[model samples]
Target: MSNDTAAQPAYFIAHITVDDVEGYRNYEKGFFPVLKPSGARFVTYDDNVTVLEGERESGRTIMIEFPSEEALMTWWDSPEYRELAKVRQAAVTTHSVTIVHSLPPR
Candidate 1:
């Protein structure tokens, strides 16, 4: 999809500090089913994260790549995800959730 960057890909970043394993598991159990329809790609998650520069809020990092910002938002804003997010909210301290766009095609 076109944007100010003219068709740049979008990525979602989640900085989370999980508090209740069972609660996060509850959220994780349903994550893929909701994520599947959006065509979002799970990049990876890092539990051993290091901050090279500025300080960060959490130690766990999760990333997902999407074809476009619209696709990412569509999945993120859906009722299923909204409901599931509550489970995550109860389980973790989410430092930040950010959407970033890649550089436009070179």
Candidate 2:
């Protein structure tokens, strides 16, 4: 693909607090399948996360890296993911999701 199509890498961050563990587990089961096809990589996922500095939301924090913004959006907007999201929405008490562009290499 051309550079324009292949663009810069992107990352997705989500801070979530689960109210229903079983329901969240169900969401987890279907998470990979939707992400795998879009080449998303799990950078980190931690429930026992600590705040080194500044304000941090309460809950499990997850960071996922994608090959590009397009890939990230594709995975997020996919029909499979949409279905899985309902499970996530029903399970979590708080959910914050954001996409960030990676800095260019020096």
Candidate 3:
């Protein structure tokens, strides 16, 4: 969060199918510490995900909220997360990772 702020909130949505259970557990063990530093907050984790529309893989859903899009990107592109992601990369098949920005305040 920069001082000269013109930032809007952001949400990260991810849909994934676990490929290796043990690997995913390992990934989870290392996930939070890396995530917290960026000021992003976990919103939800759904195992019984219901897809109401369109064609998309349905297994697990994860949502994270950030103070700003920049903060989300910073965490996403950080070396720590990148390195930790190797575990997650090997653990699951990611269907989507969407970034939704909040509408500007009126």
Candidate 4:
């Protein structure tokens, strides 16, 4: 495959605080299925407990790798996923989403 075709271009990290743990668990369980149709994949979907920090945080951290910026946007705007996002917005009090480009092949 050509580099353009084979290369996945973006990494996204999310720092989140869930207001309702039960609701967040339900939301987490539902995310992958919605994302699968858009061809997004997770590099890490770690909960806060395993994270080492000065203080324990009450939230979740997620990292996802998308095939491209376009792919990431596609997933974000997808009807299926967008609809489900309400669960997250309602449950999460504070959150951050960051996207960074991957280093291209030398």
Distance from true location, Cα of 80 in model 4, Å: 1.2
Expressed as tens digits, the lDDT of each residue in 1-106 for candidate 1 is 4465534569999999999999999999999999999988999999988789988775699999997888888999999999999999999999999999887766
**For each candidate, what TM-score against the reference?**
0.89, 0.87, 0.89, 0.76
Lowest summed lDDT over 10 consecutive residues: which window, candidate 1? 1-10
**Model 1 misplacement above 4 A:** 1-7
The 10 consecutive residues of candidate 4 with the worst lDDT sum are: 48-57
Candidate 4 Cα lDDT to native: 0.78
Per-residue alpha-carbon lDDT of candidate 2 for residues 1-106, written as tens digits (9 for 90 to 100): 4576567889898999999999999999988877889987889999888788888767898999999988888888888898999999999965678988767655
How does candidate 3 score on lDDT? 0.88
Tell me, what's the RMSD of every candidate? Answer: 2.0, 2.4, 2.3, 3.6
Q: Which ranges of candidate 2 are over 4 A from the true structure?
A: 1-6, 104-106
lDDT of 2: 0.86
The better candidate by lDDT, 2 or 4, is 2
Q: Mind giving the per-residue lDDT tens digits that candidate 3 earns over 1-106?
A: 4433437878999989999999999999999999999888899999886668867675799999998888998999999999998899999999889999787666
